[model samples]
Target: MVDQKTPADAAASRGRGGAPAIRERLTRRKPVEELVAETQAAEGTGLQRHMGFWQLSMIGIGATLGTGIFVVLGEAVPVAGPAVILSFVLAGLTALFSALAYAEMAGMIPASGSAYSYSYATIGEFMAWVCGWCLMLTYGVSVAAVGVGWGEYINELLHLTTGLSLPQALLAGPMEGGLVNLPAAAVVLLSMFALLGGVRESSRLNAVMVVVKVAILVMFVAIAVTAVQEGNFAPFMPMGMAGVSAAGATLFFSYIGFDSVSTASEEARNPQRDLPRAIMFSMILVTAIYCLVAFAAVGAFNWTGFADGETSLAGILTKVTGTPVWAVVFAAGAVLALASVVLVVLYSQTRILYAMSRDGLIPAAFSEVDAKGTPCINTLVTSLVIAVLAALVPLGPLADATSIGTLFAFALVNVAVLVLRRTRPDLPRAFRVPGAPVTPVLGVLACAFLMFSMSLSVWLAFLAWLAVGFAVYFGYGMRRSALERV
Candidate 1:
């Protein structure tokens, strides 16, 4: 009775029922310091910490080398003719520049949030939320896009091997009167479960897939390069610079996953040391592969035949080799590569949301961890939305939107490096971008140029998304920002 009579005990008990005590309130809604502290405490949680430079390089390759090379080739070759090779070089340059910028910013921050986190610390709270939102939508839509792409190729492979295939109406989108894209939805669901298991497992899976993808391309290249007739490259730029620009903009998607490697900085064993090397290595490797593939694909087929039909590697096999077997293999490769891409993009999307949630920009549930220490709630919500998208919508709109969002994010990251250097000279940087002002400026210009080359419809849709993002940020994120409380 005497012990229960204390005023301090009663006040503490009442505090639990009222608003949380000051310490509890502050802890739950973290300030920047608290956020940093929490992240530090949870070091080496989702991803393993022993990843070496070689593993990091493989991760970059695994992320970048898929869907882009196998699939985008069919779409890009017709745009620029043989000069599509040059367009690849152009896209590679922009990716490299942006990657350099990301390397510097990511190293300095050494955090899990990727571009969104860099923007938050350097720019402001509002911009960070906008970037985070855009990253989510970009990667989320990419999952659906990749899944749908995967279904098409997988069906092609089954028919090739078994001499049986599903009808178009059964396999295609609702607009095409299909009930649902079953295979595409299946791949997304499967990838989600794989990711939920753990990051290390996913990385190993990606590494194996990347090796398979590279080996297939190497076989195609080795066989096709010897067959190059001089006449095929005669009218190299038949469509000229306009065509080159269009192709560069389209081929830009091939380079999409390079930046994604940077997204794992928070999980990297030695982010500052390894991130730049990984980004550069992946870009150089993919650029060389793309150029070689473009050369081989064009060498084997006449330019005129491309105008008559979509110039896919599979189509080339059908035309030049007069055999359906190679076509089947190319299509099978596309299916596998696209499936891997969907998995990686979806993983990146959930992590970005998890980061934002932890910072109080979104709902707290997004950051909540299950027994596995994965953001189970965020993963489920993201995968479900992507699966629904795959089942219904056509892929064209979402794919274009994804490219625009990526270019915009990349441009901001380049600028972010410059901004940080000026504002926080004292911050320890694990990596520094070589050029001070000029390099980042060129990076921004290159990205902008590619962005303008995109369809006008994409620009309009992007603007609309941006406007909505601004509204959301001002209305909710601004007041709830953890940075503000700090």
Candidate 2:
């Protein structure tokens, strides 16, 4: 007699079908503990239970509080006037929704490489590759952008202190009438070496730099606040909604690196407990700092002055107080603080490539580990690319490109949160988005809106990069992908 199986057994034997099959495959891809184990084996125990709440918080702050406050203010104040404070809140809210969603996924997966790994386990191979590709775009260009900013600040500091500095040809980018930014390239290389040394070194370095950066920000607020003229806020919406939205788009960069905390989830001591705290705390802290800075900056300087340069904060301070000392301090803080940002962003970029390489989506060289147990080859390769870009390219186009790629990744994570909720409801989630469909939906739309607010030129360049990504994905990533083979 033929044996008959029960309904449950039958259902278990075959997948839910088509999309369900993919979802089932994704669901069974890797368990939370197993992913943690793999990450520990690769990244070493440095990231394991070694991180506590304080350390995690530092990571978030160190990564998020960089060029945004120092430089983005110049771009934003011109657009939103004193209302740039509101723009920070708007961007923070949107980032918060996505951060919560990432917290859920990060807690569930407990992986170090970040959203790339989370997408792999929740979404399919194609989407995973796309997200990884976009992450590379986000962090790599961010490194170059920060490096370029660093060069400018270093130049300013030298001029302030010694009354002498490197020639423009050696200190600035080619477009700025320089052959290359040597100081920027040197910092990128230095950061790469520091990262390759170990995460502990990286974190400690980050802690020290973060403290100095925050101190400078506090100084800006403390001094600028006292100089506030209420009249500055009179035409709060001078540029109107369009300008506010434009400012929101740029302000989003200030919150960009907050997600790096999620990337470090695999190494968290208690990701389910700590990841949520880290992500939320970091966002709230950054939002508060940025809003205060905006309030003080607008009150201290006329919005009309923003058009003079991208480094408006220091310039405004010079005008408001008529003291070069404040400008010197601000510029010095920016110079030092932006170096750490470059370090952190470059680290993230290399690791993403390392993850992709390990997964066989990219060249194996990226996966090669050195005696120090870091992806040295990958980090060096990234540093080389960033240095070259910093030496030759203008930051405006590249910065906008990074923003576009990041927005795309953020939008994907929001959608993936909803998809995973419906498809794998039984799966244990350490954290769940509070408003479910509403939050994720709004997150997607907000990211899209900001992405659209970028110039037409940025959109065109982003499209070109996406086309290149598609070429890479289809040409090699698809066939070689481990998930595809599975």
Full-model lDDT for every candidate: 0.75, 0.77
Q: Under the 3 Å rule for N, CA and C atoms, how many clashes does model 2 have?
A: 1
TM-score of candidate 2 against the unseen true structure? 0.90
The per-residue C-alpha lDDT of model 1 at residue 426 equals 71
In order of appearance, the predictions have TM-scores of 0.88, 0.90
Each model's number of backbone clashes? 0, 1
Cα deviation of 179 in candidate 1 (Å)? 4.2
lDDT of 1 at 51: 57
Residue 340 error, candidate 2, Å: 1.3
- Residues 172-287, model 2: lDDT tens digits: 77687878888878888889888878777787898788888989999989989888988878788888888888888877878888778776664567877888788888888888
RMSD of 2: 4.5
Q: How far is candidate 1 from the true structure (C-alpha RMSD, Å)?
A: 7.3
